[model samples]
Target chain A: MVLKDILSIIFISLGAFFMFIGSLGLIRLPDFYSRAHATGKVDTLAIILVIFGLVIYEGFSVNSAKLIIIITFVALTNPTATNALARAAYRFRLRPWFKKDKSKKIKKKMNWEIEIVLFICLLIAAFVSLYVKNLLTAVITLSVFSFFTALIYIAMGAIDVGFTEAVVGAGVTGVLLIITIYRTSRRSSD
Target chain B: MHMFFIYVSVILSVIIFIPLYRVVTGPTIYDRVLCSGSIATSSMVLILMVGVIFNRIDMFIDIAMAYSCLNFIGVIVFAKYLGTLGSRRKNGT
Candidate 1:
């Protein structure tokens, strides 16, 4: 029992570490494609590790069985989602930012100071999405907002609400908005 | 075990903001999508951890499963729609 507990702790911590690294990479990476690479591959592995740790902690039970099912679901869907998003972006003609792209304009660099700062940044993104001139960027920003909201819900112990947000908010809403942009215009005035 | 789950959850919640930073400041639409996708994936793990903390793993597992399916379908639909749009633009229809 002690050994099992120790193993679970080790695995869970490792998972959390990788998850942090993945998110860090999301912020530090240079381009869209590179950011996708960071989030998609690393986050997938982190989730698997975390879930696997939980399965071990629970031992062999109906709950662990369910967790295994979730593992399968996540493992299958994550890459597919990443692939789809990448393909969609490519199809939309959104160019990946490259180091030597001379046409790229300079923008203000983001500094990581505090967690509250991150939350404030999220609020800013939400407002920017509302006011951005590009409809596609607006939709993408909304998707980001939805995802963060889902995380907040989960942290508050509202797992069901978070799940709903994850599915409907981040998932369905993003796709619907993209479809709207496709049928209409990619740019917005003000 | 429960305590460990809580600590991990807190860590994950804190880390969520890093991706949010990307979403906010990302230069392109794809960067936002990718960042959000990362956030979604992490949320899935956090959901299961919450399940462990509350001692209700059974219910949350179902939610996680359904969430994954929805996420997958959403991405595929968006990609397919955009791909069709690109082709339509090319065909001049």
Candidate 2:
């Protein structure tokens, strides 16, 4: 009996601590996702611990069965509900908050004139690629857009990024595009 | 032992304020929903502690089960309701 009491006390104390921490996280964490992370996962664990501790205290009885049932039900549902709420928030376009460097000043460097010309061309390429009637032309224009993006990276002095963009965007993706385009016979329904 | 349970229940009650604070200040509907979930969980724990304190585990355990049922159903239904909300808004109300 003493052992049982000691065990139950230990379990319940631990559970109360966890519950406090979970609630603290709900308030202290910034933004929706972090708050969700704190409440959803931690709260579930705390409830489980508390209930199981209750069961331990109750011994093998009808009350223990009821306690077990609550634990099972909570364990199953809490995380599921948390995930669903998160998905709904995401679908509703809830923007997550993050810290930004407000004091950081924006500075212009390098040949910005060339950047302006490239940016305009990029916009034009993107537009043309989307609205063009021919599939092949769309693919080709997309490749051109990719090529221009690579040039922008070069202008930004990211040489390694520029190389990656050229290879993946202009080389591999261009080939894959042509292959996918030619592979299909049903060009258009309209 | 009863004193221990009493102290534990008091702490649980105090802990609930943190989640309640989030429910008030949370920007999105889901954040508020999440906070409510957290509070319910803590309440369930508190219910168990109360059961231990009163030495009537049978009666209080049922109440906790009922609270759990309500919490799960409310949250799930709310999530389902909000799922298509974005698409409806995009479709111009």
Candidate 3:
């Protein structure tokens, strides 16, 4: 038990460090491309480490194997798809960060307000659904407010749904938004 | 077991928020997409960890597997559409 505790601490701590570094890169990096490097690359590594720690805590369950497999597949595919998209952005003349004053002539164009509103609305709805008294309301609300519910589910140990929600709700939806935006607007509208 | 799971989840939860910020504030479309993809991947692991905590490994495993597949396909489709659309706009067609 002592050995397991120690191992769990090490894995979880390592995962957190990677997440911090990835976020730091997001803030510190000068350009969008570099920011992608921080978020996509380092974040992936951090999650895998965290998952490993969780498996140790669970002590060899059937579901743990599935989680490991999912992690492996993500590790393989995320970077490649991200790279393709980034390269495409560059091909379409998306701007990169510069050492000196840049964007003197570049046009600023993205409207982030819509996204902000969407997130806020989602947040409120998710909270309300959680507090409602019906199991059906809870599950349906979970589908609508999938992201937050999934996090809670993690705490409650509903591993499968949480895993699904994380990927589908957060990951796929994010990618879809980017793809939709790039397609509708030019590569770097803003 | 409970303590072990809590520590792992807490650490993961805190670490992943950083990448989430990047996805939110990313300057370019591709950068945002990449960050999103990374988050998706990370969340998969996090989800599985949650399963371990709850002791419902079998149920969570299926969902995680399906989600990974969806993430991969979604990215490719979006990429292809964007690539083609960019060309169309350039040609003014």
Candidate 4:
């Protein structure tokens, strides 16, 4: 294969791998705080890598410089935003999830079951989006579908969009939602 | 190379949906504010991306800059409201 093809494949694969890890973090982390940690740090890092791949593919173009600038801003802001959310949560007195010992096996088991169901549902939603319905439906289910479509843009050399997706999807959305959950209910004290 | 631009734009818009979920399901006013900020941040990125996708980064850069300023103002407004609410509740006590 040509060098461009080789690079594209490698970068895409790397991005996918990072995304997978980030998703796993979403599922496996015990609670909102840890989930924020996983989503914000690992996901942000993965997307930066994906954008870097796109930047390389777009080399020497003006778009490439813009891509780099977006990347820099994201790298700077993503973590700060997440930190701000976490601080907000802490200031509001949200508690981290901590399971009691096996002496409370029944309650522990219940929590585990709840977590498993959440994971399964999220997974199913992700899987189904791969072959779902019409464009309108797809638009509705868009977030559930993979970011693989983004690779197409990179292959086409649209670095700016790739950077935007990484920041908005992984960075801001995750932090805002986590903080919102804390701010919204009695659960903020927990 | 052109296809690259398409992919980037698609991805940028695609991810903007995630925050919309928070905006829709928000349990409180502050949540909505936070989600709106996320949306604004994403839109700013989208504006910049649009410029790049269309090969007009200069124009989009201006838009993104303006949007960022607006977003900052919005966040500050919300935060100020939050502060006042907290102080009012305290004063009543």
Candidate 5:
């Protein structure tokens, strides 16, 4: 029994340690694929370890049998599901993050030039949407406009307002407009 | 030993927030979904450890199993939803 206690302790602690590492990687990793890699791979080993420890602690019993089943289920299912999500994300065109040119060492102020340009593009999207003849294009462009507005609020440090704008302005309003267009007509006003 | 379980669970609960930070401010929906899946996975372990502390692991084991199944299904559904949503947007636009 003492041996069982020690073994369970060792296993569960190791499981917890790996779980921490996985979660850390999930947050700190630079890209979606890397984050997925962290969680998908590390958590599987961590869960199996933790559950195996529980199995050892429980000994030969119906509960242990059930735990073994869980281990099997988790082993087979976790990676498959994570892979599915990753593949779907790729299909969705959620672009990967890339580091800026290392050799150039551009000034931070210079970065604002691109930000300003993109901001102007977003502004033009709003105007273009107003004049666009196609309702679908207008709705999509308006969504982009609202999303840019949310980004501006976030930059100004009003996180709550930014989040609200992102949710209500970009997400909810866009969906409603799309639905309205679909149900009524795909035509926009002159 | 019980004290040990308490310590580990406490530490793990704290660790959960790392992924949650990503879920909240993730740049894309994929990041949010990925972090959420991680959080759910960690929660399964947390639930089991809590069960051990309560000396009701048999009950908690069942709960953990259910959580695992739910986690898998939820991610799969999310993938399907995003797949179709993307295609619909493309076809519509």
Candidate 6:
């Protein structure tokens, strides 16, 4: 019993350490692709480790079986989601950030310029979406705004609300807006 | 042992801010998507740890599993929808 307890502690702590490292990489990495690589692979492994430790602590039981099922589900879905996101981004023409480019200086300047514009636009879009004449643009801006709000909810430890926000607010709403735009006129009169 | 779980949960919660920063400042929409995915995963683990702290693993495990499924579906939908936007634009229809 003591041996099992010790092993579980070791595994859980190791998992936490990896989780920290993965989040660190997510922040410190320079580009979208690298950040995806960090979160997609490392975070999956970390969750699996932590769950395995919990399973060991629980010993043989129905709950342990459930934990195993959760592990399998996460392992399967995480990579698929990551792949889909990357493919979509690639299709959308978002270039990967490379470290050693010949035109590094020019790229750096452009990066700052675009970052500032996007930051300002993100703030403006929130308020502007409320009063925008065009419904489609308003929907797009609202989705962007909701994405940030979802992150805030998660950080606040409201995981259930965050999950709902991510799915309904960002996912379903975006799809519904697209369908609406397809059906109605693209432009709106104020 | 319960105290250990509580401490670990607190540590995990603090670790979440790292990815939150990325989500807020990510260069592209995809980066934000990735960071949010990471945050979701962390929350799942944190939920499980909370279950441990409260000695209610049975209930929380189900919630965690459902949350994971929802997160996966959300990401897949976003990707599929966004991926086709480019092709549709080029086809001009």
Q: Residues A1-190, candidate 4, lDDT per residue (tens digit)?
A: 5687458546744754564465444444455566556546765575567656656665677766766776676666655655655555554445667895322111111222212322333354355444643321222233322222322233244645644653454335434543553355432211
| Residue B9 alpha-carbon offset, candidate 1, angstroms | 0.8
Report lDDT (CA) for all predictions: 0.72, 0.67, 0.59, 0.48, 0.69, 0.72
TM-score for predicted model 1 compared with the true structure: 0.81
The sequence of per-residue lDDT tens digits that candidate 3 reaches over residues B1-93 is 665564555555544444444444445555555554555565555556556666666766676676667656656665665566567657876
Model 2 alpha-carbon drift over 4 Å, by segment: A101-190
Native-to-model Cα distance after best TM-score fit, residue B13 in candidate 5, in Å:
0.6
lDDT of 6 by residue, B1-93 (tens): 887886777677666556655554455657766776777688788778877766778877876887688668767766776687756656776
Fnat of each prediction? 0.74, 0.56, 0.44, 0.01, 0.45, 0.55
* Candidate 2, A39-155: lDDT as tens digits: 778888888887777788889999899788888888898888899989888888888888953332222222324455556657766886788665545554565566557656644
The alpha-carbon RMSD values of the candidates against the true structure, listed in the order shown, are: 4.4, 24.0, 9.4, 11.6, 12.8, 7.9
lDDT of 6 by residue, A26-83 (tens): 8777788787888889998999999999999999999999999999999999989999
Give the clashing pairs for model 3: A63-B57, A109-A190, A157-B54, A159-B51, A160-B60
Worst 10 residues of 6 chain B by lDDT: B20-29
Q: Considering only chain B, report the TM-score of model 2.
A: 0.91
Model 1 lDDT per residue over A35-83, tens place: 7777778888888888888888989998888888888878788887788
Q: How many pairs of residues collide in each model?
A: 0, 0, 5, 11, 0, 0
lDDT of each residue in B1-93, candidate 2, tens digit only: 777776776566556545544544455667766776676566556555656666766766665666566556656655765676666656875
* Clash pairs for candidate 5: none
Compared with the true structure, what per-residue lDDT tens digits does model 4 show for residues B7-68?
A: 54455444444443433333333444444444455445445445555666655554454444
What's candidate 5's DockQ score?
A: 0.24
lDDT of 5 by residue, B23-82 (tens): 544666667667656766776676677677777777767766766675676567667666
Candidate 5 lDDT over A1-190, as tens digits, reads 4999999989998998899889877766788888888888999999899899989988999989999999999999889988988888777776787984422121111222223533554565568668855554555456556545654453344445755665676556766665565456434331
Candidate 4: lDDT of B27? 36
lDDT score for residue A182 of model 2: 42
